[model samples]
Target: MARNKFQTLTEQMFYILLALQSPCCGVDCMERVRQMTQGRITLGPGTLYTLLASFEEAGLIAQTALEGRRRIYAMTPAGREMLQGEYARLKAMTADYAAYYREEEKQ
Candidate 1:
């Protein structure tokens, strides 16, 4: 059986994809991730740029230069597909955990 490409995504990759779900520049992307995680998972500038570069290399995202020093990023078709897969996986995991907890409560 062929392995799924999305299985290679680490937590950082998932967060990066989630951040790019909205079209945003680098600074905005970082801030969005921070806000979304309620400041619990703030990414450093170096890590953010590295992840962006990797995403761009994988063709999951594309970068466009904005005015002056801004590079805006948006998800590609591949990125959207990856995000969808991740969402499904997370949904299933959450549902399974919920069921397990419910059963435990009944005990």
Candidate 2:
């Protein structure tokens, strides 16, 4: 099924935040996300930039420095909080789904 756009705890956002948990340049962040997902989610430049922009605008992320042509990013407290909230929400959703499926299988 297609993913819902309203879902704030998205894989992309999660991975981005995860990548930023440590200092990372834009390209490194994208690579880290790709590696973490085992190539399942490859973020394009446009999408990555857009997400970064949104995160910065939301005060969740910040660009820390520039190494040559690369822009490094880091997670702020707000970003960490957001990530934690998303993780909790996802965990709850997974548990709910698991319980529902288990019951369904019993029938």
Candidate 3:
């Protein structure tokens, strides 16, 4: 099977999608990402906008509204599935690490 373009999301990509759990504009996405991460991750306007464009083009997200110049986006069904898959992948990875550490501690 062919791999999906978004099988694995970057830190920026993941946060951007997460920020759009509710409809949000570009600026809202940036600010929410920062807030959610407690300011650890900051997205520049260029990267965020570019990703938004690509994600929209790819059908991962859909534009829900245009409040003046701001374009608000929401995740499509496909996007939600992709995010869920990524979450599962992350869970598996962490579980493996936990198992490995537990065995090491037993030694």
Candidate 4:
């Protein structure tokens, strides 16, 4: 089977999708991402808009509405599934790290 290009998402992509759990415009999405990460992740307009365009192109997100020039976006069903898969992957990685360290501690 061919691997999905987006099988793994960059941290920016992950958070951008996460912020779109509800419909929001580009600026709002950027703010939400920063707030969600407690300012740990700050996305500039260039990066955020670029990823949004890419996500929309990939069918991972949809533009739900437009307020003037701003476009409100929401995650599509495909986007949610992709996000869940990424979450599982992250969990598995953490589990592997823990398992490895646990055996080391036992030795």
Using all chains and alpha carbons, the TM-scores for the candidates as numbered come to: 0.83, 0.86, 0.95, 0.95
Query: What range of 10 consecutive residues in model 4 has the weakest lDDT sum?
Result: 1-10
lDDT of each: 0.81, 0.85, 0.89, 0.91
Question: Candidate 3 overall Cα lDDT vs. reference?
Answer: 0.89
Look at candidate 4 and give me any clashing residue pairs.
none
- Which stretches of model 3 miss by more than 4 angstroms? 1-3
Query: Considering only N, C-alpha and C atoms within 3 Å, which residue pairs clash in candidate 3?
Result: none
Stretches of model 4 off by over 4 angstroms after superposition: 1-3
* lDDT by residue (tens digit), candidate 4, 1-107: 11276879999999999999999999999899989999999999999888988899898999999999999999999999999999999999999999999999999
Candidate 2 per-residue lDDT over residues 1-107, each given as its tens digit: 11233247678889999999998988899999999999999999999999998888777888899899888899999789778888888899999999999999999
Candidate 4 whole-model C-alpha lDDT, 0 to 1:
0.91
Candidate 3 lDDT at 33 equals: 96
- Worst 10-residue lDDT window for candidate 1 reads 1-10
| Steric clash pairs (candidate 1) | none
lDDT by residue (29-69, candidate 3, tens digit) is: 89999999999999999999899988888788999999998
TM-score for candidate 1, please give it.
0.83
C-alpha lDDT of residue 16 in model 1:
81
